[model samples]
Target: MTYALIAFALVLAVGVALLYNKLVRLRRAVENAFAQIDVQLQRRHDLIPNLVETAKAYLAHEQATFEGVARARSQAQIARSEASPTDAPSMRALAQAESGLGAALGRLMAVSEAHPTLQADAQMAALHEELASTENRIAFSRQAYNDSVTRYDVSVESVPGVFVAGPLGFKPAESLLEAPPEAAVAPRVAFA
Candidate 1:
């Protein structure tokens, strides 16, 4: 009876240890994924000022558009700084801020389209291309982050993991896949 009890405890200990190690790895992956998103978001934010400055020369009358973009960009930066994949509210805030910035940029692009001179400028063209590329990278990073979060969350919520996760402080992370209502439909920006 003593040997059987000892063997049972040994097996349970090993199983719990394995589960703990797996959770740790998944959590680390979630953090790494969010870091990638943060890097891309920083790049996007850095490019916005140059884009606005280049467009400013020809779109003098479009001050409102420029101001809107600036405001949205500032909000996004703040949200990005505070965001964590483990915190659902912070993640939601970041997504909302990013959506607002995208809408604002779209408006600026639409207004700039009216001025042929702006479209024809070499500097503006280059900046627009860079911004588009950055946007694509951000999209890819978000998708990757969401994937990581999904894996982590599932593990935290699953059977044996659920038994160990809460005791070990392994909370489920939030995914970046959910967009606000305003972002449900993409803004229309046509380039000729």
Candidate 2:
């Protein structure tokens, strides 16, 4: 009877060890995912300067728009400096700044459309393409980061993990990526 009790204890210990290792691996993956987002966001930030310079060369009248972009760039720098993304107020400001930059960039692009010479400039066109590609990469990286966070959040919240997570101060990770406010509130159309 005593041997049977020892066997049961051994099995429980092994199961716990395996679960702990899995949890650690999952947490590491979440960190790696955030790092990837940081790298891509940094790349996006780099592209913004080139794009802004190109716009500046042509859109001399739009100094205010340029300043908005510059300010957004600054806010983004502060936000990314943290080990984790900030909560609502800072996040909202960052989002608003990014949206302003996008609007300014769109207006800058429209200027290029109006000025045939500007659109035809090889360097400007190339920089615009690189900026667009960088934006896509940033979007993808954020998605991946959120996915990893989701997995980690669930793992920490569920069954056996709940037992360990509470005592260890492990809690659900904040989702850094979310649909822009415009996207969330946009009117939807349905097809038959």
Candidate 3:
């Protein structure tokens, strides 16, 4: 009877240790994913000023648009600094800031479109292309981050993990991409 009890305890101990190790790995993966997003976001932020400067000469009269983009970019930088995959509010703030920046950039682009010279400027075109490429990288990073968070959260919340996670201080992670309410509805397609 004593040997049987010892063997049972040994198996349980090994199982829990394995579960703990898995959780640790998942948590590390989530952190690594967020770091990739941070790097891409930093690249996007760095590209913004060059883009703005290239457009400035042509957009001298569009002061409001320039200010809006600068302000949005500042807010996004702050939010990105404070954001973490472990913190939901910070992640949400980062998303909101990024959205605001995108809108501001869109407005700037629309305004710039009115200036044929700006559109034709080779420097401006190059900057815009680089910015677009950075945006694509950011999107890809966000998707990767979200996938990591999902995997971590699932492990933390499921099965025997549920019993061990809390005791081991493993908390669920927040995804970097939270779809806005508008995203739930399909877009209308019309042929005019």
Encode model 2's per-residue lDDT on 28-92: one tens digit a residue.
Answer: 88778878877877876777788778877887876876787787777677766644631445545
In candidate 2, what residue range of length 10 has the lowest lDDT sum? Answer: 183-192
Candidate number achieving the greatest TM-score relative to the actual structure:
1
- Each prediction's number of clashing residue pairs: 0, 0, 0
For each candidate in turn, the TM-score is 0.94, 0.80, 0.92
TM-score of 3: 0.92
- Candidate 3 residues lying further than 4 Å off, grouped into runs, are 178-192
In candidate 3, how many Å is residue 178 off? 5.3
Off by over 4 Å in 1: 184-192
Q: What residue runs in model 2 are displaced by over 4 Å at the alpha carbon?
A: 1-5, 83-104, 179-192
Candidate that scores best on lDDT: 1
lDDT of 2 at 183: 36
Model 3 per-residue lDDT at 160: 89
Per-residue lDDT of candidate 1, residues 80-158 (tens digit):
9999888889998999999999889888877777789999999989989998999888889889988988888889999
